[model samples]
Target: MADAPPSSEKSFLRRLTVITQPVLTRIAHGSAPFITTFALIHLTAPVMANLGGTSLASQVMLLGREYYQTPFGEKYLVLAPLVIHPLSALLKRVLAPKPARRLSSILSVTGYTTAVIVALHFYTHRVAPTDPSPPIYAVGPSELDYEYVKFGLQTWPWRSWLGYLGFTAAVAWHASEGMAIIWNTWLRSYLGGPPGTKRSRTIGAFLGGVLPVATGMFFMWREPLMVFASHADRFRAAFSMSPFYWY
Candidate 1:
């Protein structure tokens, strides 16, 4: 009798609820850590290298050495674990339940601890010093060596490598599991028209998670492999003159 309160009003309210639901869902899921991790990777990598021992140009050139020299950069090695480890821990918690919960929690603490230790190590040895001078080597002739291949090896010896190994492994696990969860949650609807129309979605998701992590593992393992192959000396020779060498 009152014109049914106008069908347009009812339709508008329905549309508003639908639009707001997803916004609230995203907020509830918490994207802060993800955004933070992305930001740290992009911003900190170059800055850390630049600030490692000298000016910005020196750091950028050092970063470029990875391409022609040994496929490793100071910023990459340092920031990767810092970013990936925590993200991995987060993903592990999100995707895996029972056993993963405990494991992820442990990794979260360990990752943060590693980062703190690394920061402290850098600050004490390199940053906090008043006189930051490059190292001089007395080999063959008194020449300035600007190769930094050995820089990676020197930073983490066998024991340090073991720590990095643990960190990398954790990252791999976390990334894989996280990918699985993302697929299940986001692409599940489009996976197939009907629910579980494609039963292989789980397997597909699992592989998606595993492959990228494996690539990361390959990078992580390269340093140790070079060390074990009696190539540490060569690396040292190559990296001894790195501009980033504060010690």
Candidate 2:
């Protein structure tokens, strides 16, 4: 009689097929469209900034910047609507059951919609204010000016704060979930032994939760920290710059 496959071996095979199946499908269909979308966004940002407020190009670029910079912005703004919507739908049909597939589709759509709203909020507060004001440091690499950052914070006060909070929470949840999925698909294979399983899950959870919180804290505290640093009178006078300068 043929020997029975060990329970662990069976699990490994199931996971391996689960992971490789989607990868193969993507490869066969090609990933060029997704690549193109990212390239377009990158190429467009500077051109739009250069064009400033007068032209459509500039407006488009501003929109891109707003979408790209927000929390969970990358996934929802760029990937979900642009790439993952279709990918998730396909995956749902192929891998998930009816309810799971539906949930995945709903989440992807909801995530994308939230990103759009957040992007609009950013545009109204941050990007719109800069219009008609000569593009600050237009010739240099894109950098956030301390004044602009402060102005943004002060512009809508409560609304801005709420938006930031929502953005941060969405990002944290989405990113952590994505990481967990990837972990289960890839890392679990090599680290499947009982001794390492718990450790792996713990590490993954920590990374998923901690990274988003840290990012939110950074956004909240960054301006104050910069302002405090600017209080050195001697340094400010010598440099003819405020302590708040990003440097």
Best by the TM-score measure: 2
lDDT of 1 by residue, 1-247 (tens): 4567678987886676566545543442344244334323422322333233223323444454443234353345444544554454444445332232354353345445545555543433233232223232222211111112123534544533443344334433333344445456676678834323233533443344334333433343343332333333444433344333334
What lDDT score goes with residue 41 in model 2? 64
Q: Each candidate's TM vs. the true structure?
A: 0.32, 0.39
Clashing pairs in 1: 145-241, 147-238, 147-239, 148-238, 148-239, 149-239, 150-235
Error of 1 at 245 (Å): 16
**What's the CA RMSD for each of the models?**
14.2, 15.6
Query: Tens-digit lDDT track for model 2 on 88-110?
Result: 43554565323333445423543
- Full-model lDDT, candidate 1: 0.39
Collision pairs in model 2: 230-243
In Å, residue 90's CA in model 1 sits off its true spot by: 8.0
